[model samples]
Target: MATASHPHEHRTDGLVVTSWFAPGRINLIGEHTDYNDGFVLPFALAVGCTATVSQAAQDWSVRSAQEPEPVVVRRSGLAGADAVPEWTRYVLGALWLLTDRGIDVPPLEVTVDSDVPTGAGLSSSAALVCSVVRAVGDHLGLDLDDDAVFALTRDVENDAVGAPTGGMDQLVSLRGEAGHVLLCDMRSHDTRPVPLDLAGHGLSVLVADTRAPHKHSDGEYGARRRGCEEAARILGVPALRDVSGEGLADALGRLDDDELRRYVRHVVTEDERVLAVARLLDEGRLPDIGQALTASHRSMRDDFRITVPEVDTAVDALLSAGALGARMTGGGFGGCVIGLLPEGDVEAAGDAVRRAFADAGFGEPSLFTASAEAGARRV
Candidate 1:
């Protein structure tokens, strides 16, 4: 967890407001492996959300700069079944979780502002819930550690918000550090900070948002999760991650359904791919990890069957433009693609993706560079 400082406050209508920040995250590799108890490498983004919370005189009210209306609901109305705005549910869900846990949550007015692009598979929902949770904890002087925060935030999304997400987003958002990538082990719930000095290695990670928002409630994401669970049961393993690389062939042979076979293959191979990247980073061979990245993307495209045309096109364009490695990041179907390139080749890579999208009649992508950054904290 990042060190906390004295929260600066300003009065609005005689109520003091304090702000808390939490970052969105991008997985460098290992997509969809989180719930399967596999490995993942992700880093916190400098872009995140902030919640400015102040005690309310009446019912709890919440608003966001991105939304046109404010949500007003009483404590009794926050049963996770109220007709709250889709975005405001993240804030309300956090409050609901606290109250359900027997924590006396006072009514508060929360105003949210964020730069993290929503639905671009960047974990914006986690940032929203985490930032508000931090603000609430700080306001009440609660002594919750990182693990406690992770459980609260994750449960808020999964149970309260009905997102069915894994622990990767909330954990990485709370534990990420500057100049490092988090190596997350789902089974043990352990994380290690691996050094990632992109500039020092003369490389840059170019993130291009496909602008095709990937919604968690779309049923496609849930369907994939169910498929993995069924496959694990068929293989008699606790989860797909329990199937070793050496045992993968035999495990796949055991599954009669082709879809289950494909799902198991992707999870097991992706876990190995994550470990391979971690080793290269540990050995200070940053550039050598490119092959593993490209291979991970291919597995997602083929076995997982999650890549859309836009993401696939972006990856091909990035590779053709001299990127060391390029792959779609975040949950599949539609989201962002990250290209690892030499510093000088960054501009060309962006241009290549833009031209490819134009020629293919796809929407223009949003491009930016990302580096490791600090996690959630009061600001």
Candidate 2:
């Protein structure tokens, strides 16, 4: 655990009519495996999106300090994804889906506040959508389970936002817990908690946001996802998750497309790394997962081609500064790198990354330690 936790405001304006929290998440090992029904290990961060809902006499309003304009969408206007401001779409989408499913939603003044860095591949969008869904669950007396909420928010991201992402973000954001990473099997949707004892072992999870804006909504993200799907189709497997190490070589040889081959290799190998991390934790070998972390970064850089120079530089600096292991997290291209470091070396590791970013001509990166915290909840 981080001794100096991120500065989080649990309360806004002294009090709120009704409030809910949905946290941003960090992927411990799993990368782009979710869509292929592969596995991922991720945990929730203490810093996340906080949504406050105040009852109004009759109109639905949505506002965010992070966004430029407030969106006022009535129930009838929910069908128009393009009608609202870009930032407000996540919340509006959630309401639209829930109401369509027969949840009686009343008018609300919704304000979203978050510490999670946008475009950092930290699942800020999921946090935003889940926060609204959670707040509505509390208000409307609706029985909202994690599975239902996952579907609701995912549809918003998929159809509404047209982002070709999997359920890893939404599932982890809603179901995470303190001192544990959720091991999610995408195929079965089977999830279990993996123990994270960073504080007890004199370690911390450091997230170094490069401030290089990236979004999965971009066309590149969708293109990579399609490439992975094509690889699976060529291999005669249902999905990439079904391709084992034994079959991976044969599968790769069958693909004439060089890009598809790399995509297959990354997802297959990355899924193994995720499972390996789980095993190491199970055996109480906390330090051993570092190599897996570095390996994941290498594959993302070489195979997935999602990582950018900014991310690579940050990871290299953290490792040189004594991080046990480090890699770029999120959807890649440009985002944040997470490092597992000795508690005592946290500040120095951050300093090295800063110097590295400056030397590389990238903007100043944000460095902070995040502890695993309880998932989405009323607070």
Candidate 3:
């Protein structure tokens, strides 16, 4: 663990600075499966968030380009814990969770710079939270394991920030590996590493940010989670993981409401797709995984109702441009679409997506090629 030095260690014109990085994450497979205690395959993206921290000499102060008032917070005093605003809650919650876990770390000044687009479903919040946690953990020398770190970060988001998020983001940020897609079992907290060698197949992953913001505070996200839990309760299972895709037909027969039926279909089918993708990757068949990705987008769009027009259009554009497969990534309802394209088609695929968004009157989307990157650690 690395710790920030005393004020004398660095020159501060009222700002103490210790820089840290947290990579964004993309789910290669496993859409909406985390809450189901099912499997997910994710890899860290090249784009991520970076933060600079320094002792405030009074408390914790956060300043960002989008914020006013510097978003000041006291290290020892937290006012309006429940009503804390979105952006600030991530930083504050990290400190609170760390402290509650017996990590004696001092907080001061903080500033953030990020390439991970906020609300683009690139795990920007998780990147920010993980960076804060890593910075504080390094400073305190707590030597907390990755699991412990993820637990604290997840708690901060779910309990403190009041976002009913699953643990995929935190886990990926903490344990990701370069050039490897992590097959994560959320229930058992186990990870099986698979090499992401798509380049050899002449394919690249193109991410198109729809610029649509996903506000986790919305009840829709929570409602979906409740649906999953309710379905599990009705089935006498701990989670949807206990229900196989083959058994989903019977499960749907049991559900009277159309909404619950749709939700169950998404979870069950998505879980199966995740396993299928994992197998394809294991067998060194990258191209075949495209079908799984495309199927995931359809389920998310129609069944889960998490996809918006921007996301759908992005996927449509990519597929129209010779992409093997495309789907909306992240928590949906906006964010980014990922396309698997042949190496020669990357530029054309990106151009098609941009053209589609423009034709749809949406803002020009950001496009990038992402590779699996290492998770959180000191530079």
Candidate 2: where are CA atoms >4 Å away? 1-16
Rank by TM-score, highest first. Answer: 1, 2, 3
Name the weakest run of 10 consecutive residues (lDDT summed) in model 1. Answer: 1-10
lDDT of each: 0.88, 0.85, 0.83
Better of 1 and 3 by lDDT: 1
lDDT of candidate model 3 versus the reference: 0.83
Q: List the residue pairs that clash in candidate 1.
A: none
Please report how far candidate 2 places residue 62 from its true position, in Å: 0.7
Clashing pairs in 3: 2-138, 3-139, 16-54, 18-53, 56-108, 306-333
- Count clashing pairs, candidate 2: 2
List the candidate 3 regions with Cα displacement exceeding 4 Å.
Answer: 1-18, 65-69, 77-84, 101-107
lDDT tens per residue, model 2, 336-360: 8999999999999999999998888
Residue 78 displacement (Å), model 2:
4.8
- By TM-score, the better pick of 2 and 3 is 2
Rank order (by lDDT, best first): 1, 2, 3
- Highest TM-score against the true fold, candidate: 1
- For model 1, residues 1-379, the per-residue Cα lDDT tens digits are 1123435565556667788899999899999999999999999999999998888878789989998889888875347545777777788887877777787778788999899998798999988988988887776667898778888888888877788888898888889899899999988779999989898899999999999779887798899999999999998989999999999999988999999999999999999999999999999999998998899999999999999999999999999999889899988899999999999999989999999999999998999999999888878
| Residue 348, model 3, lDDT | 91
